[model samples]
Target: MDFLHSGLAAIQRHLAFVAVDPIDWKFYVQAFSWTVTLFESYLLLRQYPLYSKTSPPESLARHIGQEDFEKSQKYGKDKAQFALFSKLFSQCIDSAMLQYGFYAWCWKAAGSILGKFGYGGDYEILQSIVFSFTMYLLSSLPTLPLSVYSTFVLEERHGFNKVTPGLFISDLLKGWLIAFVLGAPFLAAFLYIFQWAGDRFVPWLMGFMISFQFIMVILYPTVIQPLFNKLTPLSDGELRSRVEGLAGKLHFPLKHLYEIDGSKRSSHSNAYFFGLPWSKHIVIFDTLMQQSKPEEVEAVLAHELGHWYYLHPTKMMAISQIHIFSILALFPAFLHAPPLLRSFDFPKAVAARPPTIVAFLLFQMILTPMEAFISIGMNAVSRHFEWEADRFACELQDRLKEESMTDMGDRLGRALITLHVKNLSTVWVDWLYSAYHHSHPTLTERLKALESFQAKRAKKE
Candidate 1:
């Protein structure tokens, strides 16, 4: 046993020496970053073949014709190819930035520039903010053309884009203005807290973030959304009456039903409710109203109500807080660790500590695997909530119908199918890919679950 233990220790020491002794830290950072990038890209591309191989289940086949099926497959292929190229380009840019010391150089340059203004010396936190802002501005400038091409060429090809160049430019300017208005105060507060609170900075930062998120949620429907799209109240009519009646029946308070001009930006459709309970408002996409029947629209709203019914949003918020606590607790240790800092070429001088924001960025790179795991876990929970919401919609539709147009399950199933077809969603996703990427089950899975529920209910009747 002693011999075996000695041999293992000797092997580990040799391996550590080989890993650390010969290569520059830059090479290790580049190698790890590229490896992760390539691996993720491969994971996404591999799913294309898996998706192509899987035949549609009988439940979905009934709703989608052979012609639509072929189109959907083609759609997936187009997206997969585009995604591969996008990932390659984005990762190459990121890798180049890391390899060429872009971030470190930015920190030095920003510090020097800020020093000219007499506000930079010894204020690592302010320097960090300046560095961060400069990096963000530089990185985003190159992507503007790519964004325009995707919106105009790629999305237009798919018949999804409704944005004109004028609207697009206006939207871009509005976005930047909003980002500055919202982000600057938060950045200042963040740096202030880090400087003022020494050991207690973690909890203070956590509290601030949670408060900011809650504020955003309350502001999203009323303040921010109006900047992007027009929101007009649903006119008094049968559809409005039905929606109001449905909301009343569910005991979910309705502040107002707003029809958003979603078609102004894209052909895709969506509906959502936002704000606190007292301020809850439903916003339905104009495209959805145009495409779906009044009853179908009501059905979609019912699903949204299901999320409220189960308190899924509150539950998710709680989960996020826990995650924040864990991250904040570990972050300081990562920031202070000599080896971690050394790996990133952080200054070795004892008096000159690395910027907190830079350390946080490094921490994120180290936590990539953990982040992926957390994403998978969160998506799994989200998928569960989605199923519950779907079932709630089905049951509510059944209860409300006096004379059934069709089985409530089948009605919702068809609605799902319609949305999927119209959106050109991938019909079948690989299991591993779905585990990481999907927050809701495929249309076929939900349909089957709903059908099974209806069958059991009928047997009881």
Candidate 2:
């Protein structure tokens, strides 16, 4: 453990040291970010044998083997497969590169701005807030092209996309409008607050931001989502009643069970519990209701409810606040470094701006390991929560003694496998990959957990 800690520390120190050197900082940051993103993308893409056309079919068979071979075979060698594979690969590459590109752009932009302005105490905080928000806005731009390629080109070719060009453009316009109207004020507030309060005000500001986000979460499904998609109350007869009854039994007060027209854009299916505690609602994609059996739907809903019941969102928020405050506390040390800030040519009064931005970016680069560690911890907890939800579903099954529900679990697993394969997800992900990239445990792992639970139940019987 000590050796591992030391190695991680050394890596962070080396990255920070490189970032502080003016001559190499931009190149190093870009290279580091891009390398990490591309490597992860490669690993994810390698999971789908169809994408690696270089390998002979027999070699691919041998690699994936006999047991798991049936899973890939289910998709078959149709145009759908080709379309899905191309779309998935393209989207993955776009996602990975776009994220890194945004970071690179922001680093350069902030560096340029600060170089002209100079770094100082109050100015440093203002720059951090500005860079953070500006980068977020910039990052959103690439999503337009990505959505078009994924939905119009790839999905349309596969006969999965239902959105017309007009709808797509409208959605984009609405999204951008909302971001500008809602996001700008918050960003402005953050900058002003940081400038006024300095480092001492960071925790309070972060706390307020977290609280604000929580409020948005609560209002999103009820207020915000209606602006884009029609969310009719789920009207699938007995299934709706059963879902309501289940929620009632759990004492989960859910209002407005909605079925969003997710299939209008893509075939992917999902269910989520959104909004604040008081206004929390269960939202199921229309595609999900179309594909999944009632019991499978219940199982998925139970899983989402488990997240709320366990207060996972609140806990996640708390963890994020701690991280933000820690970063804030470290600002002064990096900001005060003359050599690091000198290259930026910031005015003495506002000299903190450039160095502060540099320091923040540099800190983020070095904080990757810490981020990975926290993500691992969170994912582990999430997996446990999933298991707990499965248990809840099983408990309900036992009381009803429903063999139908067992089949529903199997069907749910099959559906997930299909979607994952289409997405080019790593089917045989190792522990390290799961820790960093996958929040939910693998399909096979979840299935195995269910099997184990059933075996224990049978033994008790």
Candidate 3:
């Protein structure tokens, strides 16, 4: 308890220190820009998970037990998950646009004010207000079109979308309205804290943000997601029975399998294990059921179960919180540099606008490498978990039958290959490049691992 209290106190002190500092527009701009760019890059990389290097043609040929190149040629035809891939790609571009617009606006606004006067007095207050408003606008914009494209253009094109455009637009408007209503108080609180604690409040603000974010993470899967999609109990007889049996054997306390109408918006299939305790459930995409065989579906579920058994989500949350706290603690050191703030002509007080934009950008630039390091670490961990999941799935398959296991693995591999081909993913990716940006291990790596696991099991039998 003392340790926890001490840590909290330390974070508060750090927040306070940074909050009171006169704005440093140069540093702000640098930091914000770097952060936006890095974040965009990370998001783009996430799209890779939906694509695999092996083409559908290759996978199909392999599926029929074709070994020779001549025999494989007969099955060589490209079939891909084009709609999902296109949508994800477009979303990545949209993300870039939104981030760039926000950062550029802040940088200009803060720099303009700071160029006139150094930090102190009324200018500081003005700077805070501008910063807060800019943030709010950035957060609010881009929802309407992004959401629409996700459902209509991408999903509809692939026969996975069911939601009408009207519905999509309505949801967007409602979301924005909610944000405005609910977010105002928080924004106001932030501005007040900035003014009241001055340079001494950065740590506290950071702590507040971290704590708030943690709560949101816990609440989102249960309270937030249901607002958008219809989730129903998994009523399929064979699938449910098999999954339940697997869960029971593995000592996993799975209670219900829910089918989410993911096809209502998109064609891509997925399954996730979400929530905790009583709220915990498995959500499988309806599209997945339509597209994959039962064994393939089981394999995918096994992967999700792997995430649960390994407690990946909780681990990730803990890591993120620690990182946030650590960064907050360092706020004071930057705030103490008056010369740096003065260099950007930051103003003092609530009414005075300082060049915080520039300061934020600068800070973000310097923090890029640190962010990359953290992301790489998390990606590494994710890949390991994926491998473990594959192993678990293999074990489950073997428990059933050797031939069944092999056939299931083959079909699942083929499904991924088809999905990737449609998405136009290159078969061979640069491993080093993937290590830095990719979250999951490469498809080739996963397939090979599965194959090796099956072979080992065969030997044991």
- Candidate 2 all-Cα RMSD: 7.6
Residue 6 in candidate 2, Cα distance off native in Å? 26
Residues forming the 10-long window of minimal summed lDDT in candidate 1: 14-23
Off by over 4 Å in 2: 1-24, 45-147, 335-377, 397-435
What is the overall TM-score of model 3 with all chains considered together? 0.66
Q: Per-residue lDDT of 1-461 in model 3, one digit per residue for the tens?
A: 45654775676665564545555545554455556555555554553443432333353445332232222222121112333344455555544544355444564565466656764324544555455556556654645465565566544554456667687777666676656554665556655675676655656677678666756657666666777888899995888876786677667778668899887766566788765544567888888788776666777777677777777777877777778766655554454444444434433331133333334434554466577678888889888878877776667666554454555555556655544433323444456557766788766677788788778877987
Q: Encode model 1's per-residue lDDT on 1-461: one tens digit a residue.
A: 45633553454444454223433545656666677677778778778785474456665766787777776777788777777887788878887777676777787788888989998457776777678778878878766777887899888888899999999999988887787778777787887887787545766788899889989987777798899999999988877987898788778878888999999999889899887767688898988878777777777777888899999999999998988776766665544455555555555552146567777777677666677679989999999999988877767645655444235566667667778887878877777778878899977788789888777767866
Q: Tens-digit lDDT track for model 2 on 1-461?
A: 45633553454454464335554333444455556555555644444444334322442333344434443333323333444455455555544644455554565566567767775334444555556667766655655575677677666654567888998888878886777667666766765665576544555676778878876876676677888778988886877987897788677878779889887777767888776677668888887777766766777786677677777777777777777766655554454444343333334434334444555555576455456467768788777777776655555556556555554344445555544544334344455656666668876677677667767776887
Pairs that clash in candidate 1:
none
Q: What are the C-alpha RMSDs, in order, of all predicted structures? A: 6.5, 7.6, 8.0
Say which prediction, candidate 2 or candidate 3, comes out ahead on TM-score: 2
Model 1 off-target regions past 4 Å? 1-32, 50-56, 346-351, 397-407
Against the unseen true structure, what C-alpha lDDT does each candidate score? 0.76, 0.60, 0.59
What lDDT, from 0 to 1, does candidate 1 have?
0.76
Best by TM-score: 1
